[model samples]
Target chain A: MAEATTRERILGAADRLFGSHGFRGTSLRALTREAGVNLAAVHYHFGSKHELLVATLSRHIDAINAARIAQLDALEAAHPNGDIPPLDLLNALVRPAFAFRHASPENAEVVQRLSALLHSEPLEIVHPLMEGLFSRVMQRFAAALERALPDLEPEEVYLRIQITIGAMVSALAGRHPPDLADAPGLDEEERIDHLVHFLAAGFSAKPLNGADS
Target chain B: MAEATTRERILGAADRLFGSHGFRGTSLRALTREAGVNLAAVHYHFGSKHELLVATLSRHIDAINAARIAQLDALEAAHPNGDIPPLDLLNALVRPAFAFRHASPENAEVVQRLSALLHSEPLEIVHPLMEGLFSRVMQRFAAALERALPDLEPEEVYLRIQITIGAMVSALAGRHPPDLADAPGLDEEERIDHLVHFLAAGFSAKPLNGADS
Candidate 1:
């Protein structure tokens, strides 16, 4: 129990520091200081700074991905004939992340910071970290979406999925320009509904005439 | 004439280096070297790195923003009764950036890189640079969208516009996973049409039932 507590402490510290300072900006020394543990504890729990980052991110992302997959599974089972609506699939794709954020207010900030860092960080850093994180989940959702939208080509489904991910990421990051004085302050549920409605409509849009180049 | 050439060269170099190396990663020395100009030349022209970035971004963005506003003006004039369709408004909001990209292949990479940088960079760096850049254009589009879609509230229009911008930025970045081997390679024109169609449908989507929370 004591050993487990130390590991949790290190991870907790890693989460806060990494979110605030970014991967390259945060030092192990600062991490140890924040966790109130020495270098040995960190080394024992996580092998390196890179490993620590993976661990920190996985703590939340793993849960979110699992929740997404489970939602998809339930949706698929509910429609064994593979006749799920696009909106349901979109909700499966989007709502878990929002739920994760709303589960704790601090999670919102940490997730946003980490996401911003991933997007802004160099390719070398972001590529490896993000490689497997979303691929499996994305592939699953892409297949489901393609099935749901029969008229749309598979490639089109994938393209829209990528664009949807961008929208979700941007919304999650919540980094609106301060000058948009009256930016709506919707609670989590409203934001999720708006996103789902917007994306569902986008996904359902017909292929443009002569859109092929 | 010579001074104008020097200024253009520096801006060009800044675009490339900043796109590839990011704001913090690119050094003044590297920029000057790439520009084939001396330190004194950069100092005399832009005065500081921050200003240099603003100037570099503005070179292309100013044109794009102006083009967007001009397109909006034309659309508004065409529909003197304020009955412009949502699709036309979306085309106005999105096409200029695509036009800017299609004008030159190099502009695509620079714009994508700078956009990625702006989204990922720390708030302190991103905030002031982005403050006035998109405010007017966003507000203009938001108001037009509100007018076009009178059924939706103003806040909803603003929210969808922000989400649309997210999709646009993500598409422009073109940083898909290398593993997604079959990712469709759409040309600039086709991509623009598809995006405009998607966003038009999204903007036109009715407010969700009981979405207000």
Candidate 2:
């Protein structure tokens, strides 16, 4: 392995601190100590704490999105002229995200924690970054889902997509699934597969009719 | 019509500040100033910032849970013979929580924002409080669900329940659900009904077999 750059080191420190201490709890002085760099270096490299946070999140998101789009491309290529299953599309979207935990548990934890911030922060703070990173990818997946499940209404498809994304976030953030005390545990692969299965089944369910109305 | 008590005013101010600025971002001095109370009064009333937060959250949770159980009881009473559909049960579970937003937009925003903390905070901080508030209610709902869907495995039921809860939290926190720029918006009632429909379909879907394995 090659030596890590100062930027990488600082980002790594920020990732862990922000994950553990939260954005507000983690201070510049503490982050500098953790990064083994002075405040001057931080200011020089990232300009401010907010910039550093955005950088750290953007780094992970780039990798995650690249993998998702690659998986989508591969699946589409493999199934040329045929619609890919909605589950496959969702799996393609979430597999790389879930893989982060396996690839780097510590960093993944930080990302997972920061995801809470993404949800809670003011729209202006998160909206631009989220749209820049995810809007196109979600649109692609939504379109693919519509093609695969032709009977479902466009609005219901959007609703399912939203709920499915919520499930994905829950899994990525390690929030709700797989933690039941009496429930049998699933390994990481199984958990991903299970989530994909649950969401696919959900997305494929028959459209709600006038009975609900 | 009556004047609000000092404690209630402090809690109300804390709720908004904490929701907007987050737990660590909002300071005691700021809280006191916003509450229109002196520091000594804050110290006397709440003892500490943590206690005040707990009180604020507890107040909402207590009311929400009571409404939930009341709905469940009412549904069960009307049905009498366990004929209620899974969707009704889910409606009972999520309706009251969602109603908070429409009931009082300001306080609801605080609760919704605070929910992000419930998700992102360390398990040690959240686990006890969550268990204290939700464990029994969830258990009752789980058992009710088991009766409604007999063929599902205990673990699978548990899994669905967890995912459903994740969806509910997302909706309640007002996070990823309502902000789609192009998606036609639903009123609060419709949103709740739609969520119930989606979750019911998802939960009612047949259990996944070994094909995923």
Candidate 3:
């Protein structure tokens, strides 16, 4: 087995701890011990626990954003002239993250749980990092969605985008909230397809007021 | 001025600390100090920090659920025979919460943020309490949704219910994700109306496969 390096060890341990215990719940001392590193090594390497968090999140953000951008690029190439269907555009937003089915289940769970927290929580330390990572990517998708739905006011489009992200983040969090009925189990691909279809209809919904008409 | 009772004080302090710093981040010692009570008082009133969290959440849950049930009952009466429109059903889920607009903004913000976290984040100490509080309410809404959309499978109804909730929780959390275009501002009423329309369309969306058709 290839030995993990100190930085990699720290990041892995931090990610798991943060994902499970949350940012403030996981202390630096506990993180150091979990990483099998000296306390001083933590500060020497990452400056502080907050910096370590930003660093850990940055690593995943790079991977997720890269995958999303790559998906968008491929879709654009195939469609040409940006005549993308709205559902196809929504799929690009979610497909990369849902691609975790190919990864080890344990690793995928931790990443998704962590991704859900980072997106949903209001911690100051985490927000700027998440925004920085996602802003450009969100803009690209927004433009694509606008082209696909020319009738949607920019504001309406924005609300639907936010709602779409909310649903995606909730699914990634993996709680499977207690249901009144037997919740159907969709395999990973079907789950993604269901989410894409649901969100496409939501995005295509007409405004409440007659302003647009 | 009415002096706060020991129980009320403890609940208030815990709510703020938990809302601002999260459940794991807030400690018993800090909570006691902030509440202007001693260590013994915390245990005297709430047993432990975990119990304290349950209590704090319960206070809000009681109010919010009461409001929801009341709204649901009123809608059912007006539409009789469960012929309620899906948007009105969706409204019952959100209208009560959005009524916070008439209250103090700070109080509303904290409660909404807390609600979002409790629903989204998984913690052993927190889940059962939340589930106990919400399960019956969810079942009622699910039944109402089923009646409104007879074509939707029970499983599809359940999934859309989850998605509608995801959207509401995300909005309450209020991160205002970075966007390509300037997001429009809507008053509380307008926001709730927008959400109802968007989610109603989502719930009414056709299933992607022939299984449902």
Candidate 4:
């Protein structure tokens, strides 16, 4: 229990530091100090700065993925008629992320930092960090999808889902932004609701004029 | 003529430096030196590093947006009867970037660097740099999209398009670990073809379960 708390403290520091300074800019010493822990404690908990990042991301990201997968699976089971309901599925897929992102309503800063780290171009260091975690979550949804739309090629479903994810990611990850100044109607709750609804429709619908085609 | 050339040269230098190093990481001295010009030339051209980012992104990003608009216009004009085929549209959107990204095939580093900058998380100095340029471009596309999908609500279309862009941006920006390894056929040409088809179908489709209900 105490170890878990130490892990949390280290993550809190890492998230703040990583977000404030890009990955390269943050240091282990700073993270330890911020966490109010010693070097020995950090090393004991996470080994190296690299290990710390993996652990930090894994701590929350894993749970978020689980939530996404579980929500998706539940949605499918609830609507098990071979006909998928897109909105519910999409919402289930995305909610965990946005919720995790804005967990502390009072402080959106940490989320923003995470957003920056996320939006920046892919890097070698972080790829493996998230690959095993997100890909599995992604694949579970893909499998459920395959069961639903058996006719569709895996590639087709994959691409379609990926595009949907891309859009949702950007919408939620607006850390460096136009300040949401123009987006008037969608409050936080509304944003989630709208995003879920929009994505569901977009994914649920057959291709444009698909019914006719 | 000389002034314009000098301005372009400065932008080129800034793009290379900023793309590789990021906003906080890059320095004006390096920029001026790379431009092979003195501090006066740098100031005369952009006034500051902040403005330099604005100008460089504006210069390149504008070209990209213009290419996208032109390409889309051409394709839609060619295909008046049916839905503006999604794959074709996806191509129109992504090819310019693909070409620009790979234009200097020998210097993969250039592409790597620029990609990093665009996906960048939160650099206080850089966020405002490209705002004016981004908003102007976004408004243009928004207006164009309004014309293309008049049947959809303005907000719905915007939200959908944002999602599509997010996926496309993520893939192109390569900000995170993508499923390309599993997506075996995603060679340069094949990737473009797939994205176009996938996104075209995506944007063209109706909302799942139909929001009207």
Candidate 5:
């Protein structure tokens, strides 16, 4: 077998430890042992467990957020005058993370396992890694939301954004969802497609005064 | 001073430990110590550590799910068309849980903490309690989704439902969110209303082909 590269080995070990034991629960010894490298190797490469996790996750978060930003940008560029529905922004948010079933299942698993790890026994060091990553992207979404509904307060928009991200993360993190009765064959792309469309429609609907007209 | 009730004490202790440590991480010794009760009293009241956690969660889950069924039924009774908008269904799913906020902020904490706990840990006992509960409710949602967007399959409905729930739970769990942002006055009901409206719209939107599209 081709020998694993140094960074690959570290990432693989970190992924295993972080996924199973969480951010705070994982130890360097466990991480080193899992990586099958010398004890000093981690210290030499990453310096600390927290740094290793941040490095490990930086790529994934960056990729997702970058894709999300790009997606939103394209949608707005394509739709002049901001006519693009706000649900389009929501679609941009989720499809980038989950659309991985086509090219790489491993990528999808990393996002999934990380979602589980983030909410589960999170290491004390996770927040700094996520700093400004989502909010930067959320600004674009909030802008789109403001245009789409045109009725909600700024404070309401912020709360909605927070709750919206939470729901997306939860959906991504959920595993044993209720099985559909007599479901159709769904490739990875199709599943992601369904998610984006459904959420877009669901989110694009106009707000009401607690009653349907 | 009035004596604390055994059941009450057990529930309280279990909530704290389980919230902090999670299902597998929590133990009977920690629970009894926190409860200021003997092991015999714990065993007499709840039988096992797992049972204590279950008993603690039972009241909240029961309240939430019961409210869920009632809200859904009311929606059905009012709409009766089996065609409630996806956002409306999303609203029905979450608003009832918010009812707990009025009873006690602590109850809201328990519910939110448990959501985060479920994200990280699995209490096998919970499956038995939650299985039939969500499966049936999901079927109702599936029925509604079919009427709204017949283009998607039931499995698609199920996956979207998972995503929707994840977002809602993560928002409420408030475990790993943008806490540093300027949070608004956002009264209890307004937050719930915002969550329902945003999620409903997001989930209701049409599927996208790709981020590029």
Candidate 6:
């Protein structure tokens, strides 16, 4: 109900501009104008465009990861022996992301666009950012997934997790194939349900054989 | 090998520049410099930067789709009754894209980078482009997938196909979770195998129940 602070305003502006124009294409002047803040204010707050991007992304990613970890903690505590179902583990990893939709609709759109943009950025920018921000949580989930799918090799577990992330990112970006006349307009809950179902099935698939027929 | 024509050289440059810098970020002057050609040559060959991008992407996508359709035709013909195994239909959908890897590793990298960049481009750019270039092939595969999975609803098939595409595009871009100390470095064939196996399982997953516990 209260007005957003200078930093929050700047981050929100950055999300919209960077989401639309990309990190490289977006200019500081434009960013400042969008935020209705001056260059001096931006410098005092975020120091550089790069740092601003980091902050803007961190605001969302940190919250999502925290929610993921909290869910994982509760799920693990309930099991005690770490025998969580793959479906529940996957839901923990995925639901937090889809939960972003429950935020104001405009905010959800900005975050999803920004997330998709991050994936398409050059490897130099994205790789280090992901490694720095996501390594801990990603590794935690990988270990949990490995525990849940004991029959699968660790490498296989990691590969499926990567593919699952891809599906999640794609769905978040709403990157469906072009132009289906009767494409079902699924609600947020249905989207999450379908994604989790697909991923859980993938994670449970039998290990590949060279002569798989 | 024969020398590449002036147009070929310009198309090649467009792919690399567009792939790395993005469509909006890459300038005509920069593209000319990269191709070792003058601005006139690019204009003469492709009319505008937009058309140049279309030509560059079309060179690869057209071939990949042709391969996909060819494989699909063979699979369907062999099945005769439209009872083709989902895995084979999936293979038809996926294998052609991965085959790009065999066309010299450098060219393969360029195509993959460009494809990833395309996904990140603004919807106005990507949407029309995809519809114009890919709609037919996408619909064809969707119908085949629907036939292959009789138990699933058409919307469910489309959603899974979209998710499969997300997974495939992510894999093509070589997007992975960062910092797995011994993350298995899957070679090309192995990567395709793992992907097909995962997708087949996902496509064949039982339809979701509301109270899936």
Candidate number achieving the greatest lDDT relative to the actual structure: 6
Worst 10 residues of 2 chain A by lDDT: A173-182
lDDT of 6 by residue, A3-58 (tens): 68988888888877877666656788988888887877888898877678778878
- Candidate 5 docking: what grade? acceptable
- List ranges where model 1 is wrong by over 4 Å: A1-10, A21-29, A36-55, A121-129, A175-179, A209-213, B1-9, B37-51, B119-125, B175-181, B209-213
Interface RMSD for each predicted structure:
2.8, 2.9, 3.4, 4.5, 4.2, 2.7
Model 2, C-alpha of A83: deviation from truth (Å): 1.7
Better of 3 and 6 by DockQ: 6
lDDT score for residue B154 of model 2: 68
Error of 5 at B2 (Å): 7.0
By DockQ: ranked, best first: 6, 3, 1, 2, 5, 4
- Top-DockQ candidate index: 6
Tens-digit lDDT string for candidate 5 (B33-100): 88887878877887766456557776777777777778778878888767776666777777666666
Shift of residue A4 alpha carbon in model 6, Å: 6.6
The alpha-carbon lDDT assigned to residue A149 of candidate 6 equals: 82
lDDT for each residue of candidate 5 in A1-213, tens digit (9 for 90 to 100): 237987789788776666555555677887777778887888788887656866777767787788888998899889878877765677787777765423554444445545544544433544544555566777777777778768765566666566656656655654444454645556556666665565555455555344323
What is the C-alpha local distance difference test score of each model?
A: 0.77, 0.75, 0.72, 0.61, 0.64, 0.79
List the candidate numbers ranked by lDDT, top first.
6, 1, 2, 3, 5, 4
lDDT of 6 at A94: 88
Off by over 4 Å in 6: A1-6, A19-27, A40-47, A209-213, B1-5, B16-27, B40-47, B114-116, B209-213
**How high is the DockQ of candidate 4?**
0.29
RMSD of 1: 3.5
- Candidate 4 residues lying further than 4 Å off, grouped into runs, are A1-8, A16-33, A38-51, A73-88, A106-123, A175-181, A201-213, B1-58, B72-94, B106-127, B175-181, B205-213
lDDT of 1 by residue, B108-172 (tens): 65666655555445667777777778888877877788888888876677788878887887777
- Runs of candidate 2 with Cα error greater than 4 angstroms are A1-4, A20-25, A175-181, A209-213, B19-25, B80-83, B175-181, B209-213
TM-score of chain B of each: 0.86, 0.86, 0.84, 0.71, 0.74, 0.85
